[model samples]
Target: MAHVVSAMASETSPEDLTDLSLEQLLNLEVISASRLGQKSSQAPTSVSILTANDIRTFGWRTLAEALNSMRGLFTSNDRNYSYLGIRGFMRGGDYNSRILLMIDGQRMNENIYDGGYIAQEFMLDMDLVERIEYIPGSGSSIYGANAFLGMINVVTKQGKAIDGSQLAGEIGTFDTYKGRVSYGKTLKNGTDLLFSASHYDTAGVENLYFPGYDSPETNNGIAHKMDDERADRLFGKIKFEELTLSGGYVDRGRHVPTAAFDGIFNDPLFFTDDKQFFSNLKYEKALNENTSLLLKGFYQGYDYYGDQAYIVNDARVINHDEASGRWWGGEAQLTTHPFEGHRLIAGLEYQYDQRQRLLNYDLDPYLPYLESHRNGHRVEVYLQDDIQLLDDLVFSAGARLDYHHMLKNLQLNPRVGLIWSPLTNTQFKLLYSSTFRAPNAWERDYNAFGFVDNPLMREEQIKSYEAIAEWRSDSNLRLLGTLFYNDISQLLEGHLTGDADGNYALINAGRFHAYGGELEAEKRWSNGRLLKASYTYSLLTNENRHGAWANASPQNLFKLHYAEPLFDNYLSLGLESIFIDSRKNGLGGKVNGYELVNINLSSDKLIHGLDTSFGIYNVFDSHYQMLGVSENIDVLRMNGREFRLKFQLTF
Candidate 1:
């Protein structure tokens, strides 16, 4: 398989420069790095791209799984929610508010929590993905907000790519089942349309034990039948001429087993429901060969509902949490290359948050504790210029200004980078960037889960400096290396306040400094073998509290992936592994280090238009404790082993 792909890549037309030096070939083409579509080799940051082929070959069931295999990035799961940790920077109470997730250049973060879900709760199913591009760095100068640490762009498969109806089904560990239905086509009038819907459910673990709830009446720290999950999703897209319309909907339900927040044990009253609906329209026109104009508009709606059984003085107090948000935004961009030495891209963006609502109540007693609704707006503009200073050097510089009602000052973020291509298939880069995250409505004024409101919360800021190098050797090998330093200020943290049973208050009183580096290597052989390996080393310390910051994820992470074909392309085997170092837990003790191994076997062309796959996760059934949020100071024991078998048919 590897050799086949390489042969196709090597078989390009000579007029297209396939036999020329790779550097000169790249020089003739440009990349959409940072949304400017500049030179690929001269992009101002480190990027990793994976296509649908890679996703299928690895049997990746979710986006989080694919991301965890990458260097300098990983995710944590407490069974209730999943959080993304990057560059040793995800704190105990953080909600993934610093990263930006986009589907075809449209934002996916909710308005209230501002979290970018990466697990089953993630918006799009893995089967619909065409490619995923991950750009790691501070990108506020180009994306405005929530692009603090990195950006993930998910591109869906076009209608022409599918060109027919498809059905896929799977049965997995813990009584899990999934099914998908899809249809796509290109009409005779040059119209393209695609649609897909998926349904999933799992019985989850039968029982879980938590040390915090150990007691005679509590079944000795065990909760029975408390873990279950279900979800439904739909997505569609239409493209005609220069216009495109796309939308999606996701609804998820997850049951909690840890009995967090002093909730009753072994009860059915602990669950959360997350729902989202979004749509976007885009149009582009080229005025001339050197100039283009584009416009986009989007609408998003979100709702969250949670039910928990709380024991207040031994009384059964049922808390019903509800929230909603409605947002609409528009953008205009102009790209031009007026002269030979320079290319420029500029854009203006505005968003109106028409409604943000939050309310919580005691359902049995019919008591309302808090209710708030707000309306706000934001405006931003940015410009970036890529200049060819010399034959071998490229310089890039940009800045963005944002205006928001809650902001004390207009935020201005700047980014600058220098790329040096001193030799063929080799590049070095130096980059400096700044980014900030605006306080959300919940962070500003909402009271829930023993958390008090702080309407005057300030924005958080980050500054970073990084160096990177890349080389593509002649012997079918690629190497990447990166080193970075980050300084953060005015971090929004939940502070304990008031009397003995004090409520958690939102405050901007935390600070941190971190440094990290990562190295990765890859090889593809003509004998149909592939290999990838990566290692990351990092250290993070809190300047305000004088302790390790977000140390739950390993500071030292190593990963490997190897794949090969067997039995004349009728079967393929993939092996994967990850090793992580020990880290501190919330209760002042060390969580042990652990390793995981996963294997997959897939068959293509076993029969006409039919494919199959079998996978085993946690091959050794290694047991580990997953850390928790600070406010909910309870660790969740993860599942031991899991297996899945899937089949697909196309007619």
Candidate 2:
């Protein structure tokens, strides 16, 4: 667990948070919960923070792996993309539009599909990440859209933290290799500069077996030498005084071994490429003792291209699918103390989507199947107030209104929270909020060979209620609990229309309800020893049919993490365990439950300025499967075991 530090007025200069005692750290202050620095107990929602130390100790390879260790979240992969499951509600093959992702306070979701890429396709390398802030619950009242279930903000390290140049390299199982070079320095003129670049490639598994495709022509159920992937990333940042500029870019390509979407099996031509780029500029200034002003502008773009090999009239043809998007946005915010007990925050935002295009074609005959192009914009205004009614109690209320030209609709969302401190070390909170997600261009206008367009699709909505409690003891132990329920309506889902060719269409499902509870316990020692555990239970049902929802996540999840310093503080060991219950596969069949064990060993001071780590994932070699996208492959097998060794030197 990351130690909480004292609150500061400026958001960028948080170097103080790195140096704090255990007792002070227990009282954590989170920024994403309220868009400002505040104690966890006083914030409107429950917050979880993971620091760069955690990443190094646990040897987490990706953002998905780090987030899965949290209390009430899980992630699944379809071999093409990774999808996040929140509160036991997950739709297979989803693009992760329900969760909002940010990097240094800038949105990462693109304009066309609104997809939040979390795996290797993500723009930033894990080495540059300073910390991750997770605020679980609806945040549309502040962020406008795509904040239905959770808001994750990834904070990057400052130039002062690095202070030099660094080079790193890693080798992993399946012929995987990675290399990185970074430079950061703060000059005597009070200016800071940072830059980093990374490259990764992997041959993937030598062979993968799919029982559903167990035919002689499909290489006897085995796909060989077709799961290769490669990626490259570049990032940079500059800061001086009240102004900051930062940008990042990533390009990745992955081969599809499962032959999803009725592609030809054992074909190496089936693959997809994704490229994403974004740049942001921000300014912060203090107008007076009681008022502050902030401004930001950002531009982001995305491009996706895919090739699927299929047999048509006993001949192989490649289907080329392409999509591209470009968007730019600006925001202005003001924070002031209006009264003796009231703090007010107000902001306005506008976004212009310059390009949203999708197209599909064949290379041989050069036949164009589908072509769509469009542009749109959005405007939003939000305000929030936190009032201290008593010495130990606070009330918070906020709302936002958004107008979208594409949807031709206006939406308003609200949030309210009440917090009370009954004892010196105990606190309680009650929260209520509502959020919505508009259908993206992919769902509303994508008409392809195996899909139909639905231009009249509407937005989905959710209402959530939660109660939370926190208690801390003098023995360096902390416990937290939360109970919550959510009502969801008009969920967009792909439905089989019973056509002879098995064409699918996107439609809004009627209604759904989910209830869950989470419990977490953490203990820390003064000698660098730590123990943490958490359990989550959720039940999700379809209100329209009075039955369980299809492809929903497991009802129970348990996770544990432990770390200990060894060899006179020269080395450390980290261990973790994860258990996931069985889940339905949407085909009236169930995927069995499984558990995993991961271990890591690392040391930063053993060789002075040199850091090294060794990690083994899935030590027990557990066998498991996850729900797939198409009917041909209803379930996809998971990886069994892997190994990685990394070294970094700073000069």
Candidate 3:
């Protein structure tokens, strides 16, 4: 399967460059390291750029949804939360602390359980996002700790992109509804300001299943319980000359059931309301024609709560928990062209995080409360040199040193890359890098059953390498192919001990190796028709004994998308299909493979002075699960196939 896809990708024409307006393409810069003065093709890592157009084409409503279509990205069925695993390493429910998420260069990873939580509930609204830059390799050298797997940087929309006022609304399966409004203006002082707000609500589907667990006498039966989610978000951005400032707030709530054992269980209501606020201040000043300084500072906070009820040992238990944290950081960057054909970038960064958590139970009123607090400080210095060794060749090397106050350890990471343009329209690049992950607060302090914290947890490390070949064709066809491998060591895993609680303690006792290849192609027809396709194949193996562990990585993944304009200047149609190979859940249980199909039709035409659009998700009603949780007896499902429709207007 991989060979076939590779052969087909190689046959694509090599003269095509992306067809985009200068402004639109420049907007992609927010996520493009090349645009950020990081050597583009020569960066020592694998990176994918998702432009605003890509987001619009997918009709995504959130950052999690927007990332769903990527070759290596997947979301849990719950939709409200998602995880990104590079190669084959990934964390379970507590993903935020394992992966680092950034907005406009500010760290958003909050000190939580064992790692930072993504705070998916409070992430910027999709309408406020301009681009997403995904680096799928160890970024600890440049990003630190939570960036063990990779880093995702979300760049918000600027006022210049908002041509006028806009409004949109959507309704879908399971009584789902969403609405959004955006406004932008240029002040007399030449400063650009933009504001956006959006809301989403859903009474979700009843497709979940609890094995051997059923209420034969009830109308709701054993089918998964009904779930619901609500979210409200607001964002604002101001740009004045070389400085840009942006921030946002979000309030989100969700109700979910707990994992059950057999037919006897408790139906729990899970609620999470997250409030986040962030601001970024950047200054770009040129000291000379060849030297420039970039300064950035950001602060973010997460006020989060999780409330739920569950049945344990045939006894009903209710849990009310609150977790809150604040994170702030600043960076200073200097870029200098000290010699011909060479560029140097050096930067220093510092970040501080603090969190407080409490858990109380109503059923066991006499039980003592659980309280936990954590503080972390990170400081890093990095330098990169991009040398144009030849007219068509570039060599780049970089290094970073990081200090973690909690661990009292210092780490040094290094990266190297080479790019060669053997042909005018073709480029071949090679990259290698080493990155590390620090333990999260929860991972180090939480004392829950089934899990334990280790203060002496060694950092997780990965040595990754990739080779890519890309070609552009005159016929508007572009092809890109990459082969990659990753060696992971010092992974944090729970070592089961015969303790009274049957819990496992955290230890550096796991190792994993993974290799994969990906092929992507896009073609543009003269009549404005576009076709895009991608395929990914990966193989992963665990070298440690934990449980009934097997290959957890999906073996095959594919995507196809087609888009065309219709009805003159008023309408567009997009068709998409996604496929995933069968894989094991976190518990190492196998799941059946599935495919999904989606269709979207939109119009920008004026209908009675209103700009409107409508879209349908999961058009084929394919039954699929986005996430699975494994316990002693059963596997719990989170998401299933559903439908959605949306409309918008402007006054």
Candidate 4:
């Protein structure tokens, strides 16, 4: 889809990207993909950015929707939760603990479950986001933990960008209603602040049917009047010179429609709740022309609650499960350019988990099943360097060491990369990296109702090697290619084992290997008209038979986005499409391919200050399914066609 760049953006403008020379385009600065800020052409890894203009033009409400448009990535929704599948590794029951999610360089993954929310439940509203950067590959070398598959970095808008107060509203299909109020101010003293609050609600999917539970005991596999969702969000930020403060909070609830975990089907009483609060203060100082220092302190709290209805003791009853956590951390970093063609960056971080707790009980009979509480802490240090041997050759390397109370040994991760600009319009890169994910509170302590716990479980490890090439022609055309090989070992998986308390325990099951490549091409015009397409091919295998489920990720993925300006930039129209190929499922069956198409129209000044957008999703209403397990419902069906209309006004 087409996107309109605003004056407040810090990224390279569409005009510059389309009309500028190759040498000028190579000077754009970017962060997140590499902790050290560097030019886009020199960044060690592959990076993709989606700006606020794109978000508005595409009419995307959730991060998941925006991610679907990104290359080498896709998400599968089972009506209960959405899981990110990266480069052909989509585990069925995972909580997206493999991908690290960050808001302004701060980690968002919780300690209790090692989970990151990317759906409507995400902490901040989409309107407050300035840009989203997707970094594909292992990242633990600098982040220290939970950066296995990929990483997502979200940058928020500055107060000067908003300028004043704004109001927005939207009413869409499925009775979805949303409203927001925001204010921003920038004083003459170089102080700026932004505050916003939003509310959203929807009566999602009134009824649905499942064929897996077609017995009289489970309401004949039908779910009715049980799909509803709502959320309230608050966010604020302030900055003055070298000091900055930011905080955010969110509370979300969703009604279960799939009757998962053997819960009663068609019941309206099954639901889940998520709440989070985070605050941080940061300071920075430039000691000299080529050296700087940064310090930050942060606090975070989280709570998760769930209620499921079940047939217990020949009666309808409820199972209540809850978890809450709190933690505080601090970090210090220093950067120096001590000599010519040499730059070095170093950092140290410490985090203390104040409280990690989980509880399971019965609401109908007033009984307690399990209660677990634990405290943990972590320490980490890292260093990275960049060297420019020649005008056309560059080398980068980094490593990190981490120590955790629950982990028996210290973990060390490392990364190395090389970049060569053979021609003014062509660049090549080679990279190698290692990352890991440690066991979380649930995996280490909670054996609540039926699952077993193995405290001896270790961290999961990954090693990756990749080669990339990017080329640009004089006609404003771009071509890019990337190939990678990933080896995953010491994977934590829950298997049916004859343990004393239950039948399932988490252990280091086996090894998995994957190799894939992505190809993309794009053409752009001086008028902001864009046409882009990409294709992906992957072949994934494993050392053991049980790891076949990881192949749920599509073997072939095709994506296209096109847009054209009409009526002298007053109106815009765009189209998007995605095609996925069949994949081998865990049950020895093959899941068929599906294609989705979307169209949208928007006008910026049709009514002067009133921006309007209309869109249609899933135009063909194709039905596709994803892999599932016993604890979660399979035979799940995706959403059909839907319509959206939105309006926003600024003062």
lDDT score, candidate 1, position 114 = 78
Clashes of each: 0, 1, 20, 0
Which model is ahead, 2 or 4, in terms of TM-score? Answer: 2
The best-first sequence of candidates by TM-score reads 2, 4, 1, 3
Error of 4 at 96 (Å): 1.1
What C-alpha lDDT does candidate 4 achieve relative to the native structure? Answer: 0.78
Error of 1 at 320 (Å): 0.2
Residue-level lDDT for 416 in candidate 3 = 79
Candidate 4 lDDT by residue in tens digits, 1-651:
000111212355432322333333344444522353376556787766666766766677898888878888888776667778888887765778888887877788887887778888788899888777777774333566777888887777877767788898988888899999988888899899899999999997776667876778667777776778898999999989988898999999998877777777777888999998889888877899998888889999999999988888779889998999999999888878889998888888899999999998889688887789999889988888888878988888888889987799999988888889888778888898997778888889867557777878998989988898988887778788999889989998778777675578889885898889999887766675768798888767776875454557688889998877789988777788988776656655666778889887888789867878898988887766665544335446676888888887878
Best TM-score among the predictions, by candidate number: 2
Q: Which sections of candidate 4 miss by over 4 Å? A: 1-27, 32-37, 139-141, 215-220, 500-502, 546-549, 583-588, 629-632
Lowest-sum lDDT 10-residue window in model 2: 1-10
> What ranking of all candidate models by lDDT puts the best one first?
2, 4, 1, 3
> What range of 10 consecutive residues in model 3 has the weakest lDDT sum?
1-10
Q: Which parts of model 2 have CA positions greater than 4 angstroms off?
A: 1-13, 16-28, 32-37, 139-141, 495-504
lDDT tens digits, residue span 1-651, model 1: 000000012344222221233333333222252342344455777766655666777788998888878777877787887877787767544567788888877888888877788888888988888766676764323576788777777777777666688899999999999999888888999898989999999999877777666788778777778888998999999989888898999999999887666677767889999999889888877889988877888899999999998788778889988889999998888878889978787888888988889888999889898798988888988888888898889888888889876677899988888889898678898888887889887788777668888877888888988899998877667788999888888988878987477888989987888788989887765554668899998787888767555557468889898978898878888888987677677567666667878898888679987779999988999886568543333455578889989998766
Tens-digit lDDT track for model 2 on 1-651?
011122343443454344333355545566522443266556777777777777888898888888888888888888878888888988666578888888887889888778888899888999888777787764333566887787777788887778899999999999999999999999999899999999999999889888888889889889998888999999999999988899999999999999887899989899999999999888887899988777888888999999999999999999999999999989888878888998888888888989999998999978899899988888888888888889888888888888876566799988888889888788888888987888888788888878898777777889989898988888878899999898989998778979898998888875888899999998877766779899999988888777665355789999999989899878989898988888888777877877878999999888889999999999988767777666767778888899999999999
lDDT of 1 at 70: 78
lDDT of each: 0.77, 0.82, 0.64, 0.78
Error of 1 at 174 (Å): 0.2
TM-score of each: 0.93, 0.96, 0.88, 0.93
Candidate 3 per-residue lDDT over residues 331-433, each given as its tens digit: 7877788999888877788777754454544446444455677676888887878788999888877787888766667999887778887876677888778
